[model samples]
Target chain A: MIDLSTFLKEMISLPGLSGYESPVREPIARTWQPLVDELSVSKLGSLHGLRRANVKGDHHSVLIATHMDAIGLMVAGLDDGLLRVMSIGGLDLRILVGQMVTVHGKRELPGILQMIPDRLQDKSKAGSPPGITDLFIDTGLPINEVSDLVKLGDLVSFATPPQEMSGGALAGHSLDNRASVAALTLCLEEIRKFNLAWDVWAVATTQEEETLVGARTSAYEIKPDIAVVVDVTFAKGPGVTDYHTFAAGKGPTIGVGSNMHPALGKYFKTLADEMDLPYAMEYMPKSSGTDAMAIQVSEEGIPCAVLGIPLRYMHTPLEMVVLKDIQRTGRLLARFITQLETDTMEKIFGERKA
Target chain B: MKELIQKLCEISGPSGYENNIREAIKKEVTPYADSIEVDPLGNLMVRKGKKTEGGLRILISAHMDEIGVIVTHVEKTGFVRFGNLGAAFPWYLPASRVLFLNGTRGVINSEPREDNTKVSTIDQSYIDVGASSPEDCPVKIGDVGVFERPFMDMGTRVASKAMDNRSSCAVLIETLRQLKKSPHELVFLFSVQEEVGIRGAVTASYAIDPDLGIAVDVTSVGDTPSAKQMEVGLGKGAAIKIRDSGMLCDPRVVRWMRETAEKASIPHQMEILRQGSTDAYVIQTSRSGVPTGAISIPCRYVHSPSEVVDVKDLESSVQLLLKLIGGPVQLK
Candidate 1:
């Protein structure tokens, strides 16, 4: 069994921005090595761990893709020792000031992402939100030393430590996806003891934030008959009480939209109901904003579904996810995998006998 | 072509919910395409000339989705808070009449601004569905509504919602109908979720991996009243794109398209769109890479419900595509 709390903190503590995922991929590869039968890396740097089915006859495969990349900043230029930065993903500039970060340069340096004081700017422009050019990372070192230590294009990840909140919620940066990765990890651990009818491919896709490159290529390479993508959705919190956001600590969400296959979605709902697990139905209507977007259209087409973990404060430094939700998502994935039969394709494609 | 444009633009299909528009396009191109498949992402992949062996693969793409609003909250008194499905501005949203997918009507309005310190984002806006209470209203949370605009025939100019790509869609459908026989294999893709990002094109491009990719979409025009300085204009025939915010057209493809338009006696102009991009951006970078260019139909007031495009410009775009893809042409 995996300790969810320790694994989550260790994963988020590493610096793996969208295009740069090695720091986080190394730890995940180590943990998933013993659980999977074969492991390989894609040309785009996505980590794939395949577990062949124990069944004797012809078998298809099901892929469970969880993006391991986290949103962070890249060094754009040097501004008088203060590093100018650009967002690597969808970042709201409003929440970036005064946050703690770890700058990966010559050596790791603890720094604070800061903005010029409000009083220093012109009065008319003061009320307006500061643009990316106005924000810089202050490392508290002298100009010459800062220039020598940090170079251009260095990755800067949020350094907020994981905090255990009341009622078993884990709060930290990168929980938007690392939490989903943890859930997939838990699913892999649970399925190791079972005899599945289909082969299982657990992929940690990369660059899902900037582009769907990793997921698109990996899905094309694997050519799985079915794919279920696990990603994070907005959780209900302060200023986030809308139908678009789900209730945090409730359960995982099953996606419904053009991107999600109806049969695959129905299976997840049916499984959750049979197991008496709490889950919500998220209507994507179009893009699920997950790896399923790419996986669904790989090659000819693949029946794709999405399982989303409700996460609060997505794309921010202090994201939060309920620990119980992660466990429930993992259990749901395991149960769904066990239920797949050789005729599952017929069932999913609506060829089932009446 | 006008009837097809009006038929497509009148349907209500936002970024993620492209079912209505997809069905309409499927019915229009069913007779022309050799085979048609709706990808899992809701992109209608229609192919022609599949019998040609070892032919150069060409992909022509146009997005079917338009910008709209998704219901975020339904208040007890029937006031609904909404969020944008794609790129939307609060300045253009006030007092716009919208219709939901389920046939419910609403009017978007905003709270009175006492000061300008805060940005007037979508959060400050709500949709009034004219119900005494939430129970009396048919709208629910997560329901999407598109601007309810009727297609208009402004003499030579046509105007409607979603003309940004529906205009291009009409061009694609017309091209399919007009092309005689092409030695090169052709794939026409009506991509989805393009309003949110250039999302549907990424997978569609990877699936096809065509030798040449051309996205057909609308481009901003400089002919409008006090419009931002752009070289493109309405009634300028087909706009051969050179640069945009998201992509730089491959020089070889650009040269080929320009030569084809000139030699075919099609009225054409060059486009350097300042801000937005089309599906060609993502398709150009797929796999190793595919030489990509875009044929833009010049339009005014893009992303608004009342976008305008010249009918002659639409016809020219269709003719240009037919000339380029009617036979195999060398990329080198």
Candidate 2:
């Protein structure tokens, strides 16, 4: 049996910003090697693990993609021994002040991300949130040592360790995506015992935080008959209890919008109901802001669906998720894969009965 | 053509919810198309002409989506709070009527400030659906609504809610019906979600991988009072686009469109829109890059409920498109 909590904690501890995921990919490849039959990497460095169909001459394939990149900061310039940084992805800069970070420079250096004092700031900009120009990373070292250790264009990642909270929750940085990676891992492990009719491609895509390059390129290479993109969604937290958010501990969400195929979404909802799993229908009127957006449009166009794990404090260092929701999402994916028949495309396309 | 424009503009399809409109358009083009397929992103691709041995693959596109509002919250007083799907300006929203896909109706209004100031943001506005409370309210969170104005045939100019692109859609439909024979392969794409972004064209063009591309859509004109400085006006025939904010028209494609218009003696004008773009921007940048240009119908008050377009301009656009795509297109 796979321990979900331990796997997630180990994955989140690694530093893998967008477009640079080797640090995290090495361990993920090792964990997924035993669960899959054939493993390869895409040209853009997306990990593709294929488990061929057990009982079929020629079978269709389904790509289950989960982005493994996280948002962080990069050194833009050196400002008098302090590192002036730029954000790699969408980040709420308001919560970035006074946070711990590990600057990946010539050597691993511990630093604190801080904003200049209001007294030192310009008179016109005081009492407002600091912009990227106003923020810096201090390593508590002398100017010569700091300048020698850190170079421009180095990566800086959040150093907050994953913490286990009461009620089966985990909080840390990179939980926006690493949690979904864990869920995909669980699905791969669970589907090992099933005799599936369709080939399964578990893709740990890269660059979803900044550009969807990984999802876009991988889908073109795989050319699967269908795809399901897994990612995290907003959870109900302090000051965020709208319909767009779901309860963290309750279940995952099945996306319903233009990005998702309606028949595929209904099929997931039916399986979830049969398995007695609680889930929400997330309505994304435009972009789902997930890997599905790119995967759905690749090549001749593959029918795609999005599965979301409810998370709290997205893009923050202390983002949180319920461990139970990850397991539920994993089980739902396993059930769907096992239940797919050779003629499942007809049902997915709403052409004829299976 | 005016009736088709009204028919297409009246259907309710915001950026993401394009099912009804897609079905309606598919019905109109089913007889003329050789093959039709709806891509995963809801882009309807219709192939009209057959491919010969060395024929060029051409894609002409027009987006089928419009700007609207999506409900974000339903208050206890039966009023709903919403967000814009595609540039639903707050100043154009108040006192406007809207219709949801499920036949629900509502009127948009803003909260009065204590200091009696004007509401300048969407957060200050709400929609009243004639319900006394949330229990009786037919509107739910995530329901999308578009402007609920009937189409008006104002002499030579037509006014409607979604005339920004539906006028172009009508132009494409007429072009498909009129073109007799062609040596090159033609793909007429009725794309989705162009209002949110040029999303549908990005995927559809990648799938089609055309040799050359043309986008038919509406453009802002200087005919309105004190409008931004522009040379194109309402009745200025077909506007051959040179540049927009999103893309610079492929120079070769621009020259070809202008030369084709002049050779045919179509009432044409050169257009250089300072803002906004069309599907040609993405189709030009599709896989390995395709040389692309656009034919824009001049309109006024774009993105507003009652966008106005001249019938003469629509006819000229259809004529230029037929002449351009009805024969072999050689970029060299």
- For each candidate, how many residue pairs have backbone atoms clashing (under 3 Å)? 2, 0
**Candidate 2: global Cα-lDDT?**
0.88
Tell me, by lDDT, which candidate is best: 2
lDDT of 1 by residue, B1-332 (tens): 78888998998889999999999999999999999999889899999985376468899999999999999888877898999989876777878889999999989888878885654668988899998677988898899989987899988899998897899999999999998998888999999999899899889988998878999999988777776646578997899987565655665688799889999999998776657899988886687456689999999888887999999999999999999998668753
**What are the DockQ scores of the candidates, in order?**
0.04, 0.02
Cα displacement (angstroms), candidate 1, residue B308, comes to: 33
TM-score of each prediction: 0.56, 0.55
List where candidate 1 sits over 4 angstroms from the true fold. Answer: A352-354, B1-332
> Tens digits of per-residue lDDT for model 2 on A229-338?
99999998777657878999999999999999899999999999999999999999898999998888888788898999999999998899999999999999999999
Question: Which pairs clash inside model 2?
Answer: none
Please name the candidate that would achieve the greatest TM-score relative to the true structure: 1
**lDDT value, residue A66 of candidate 2:** 96
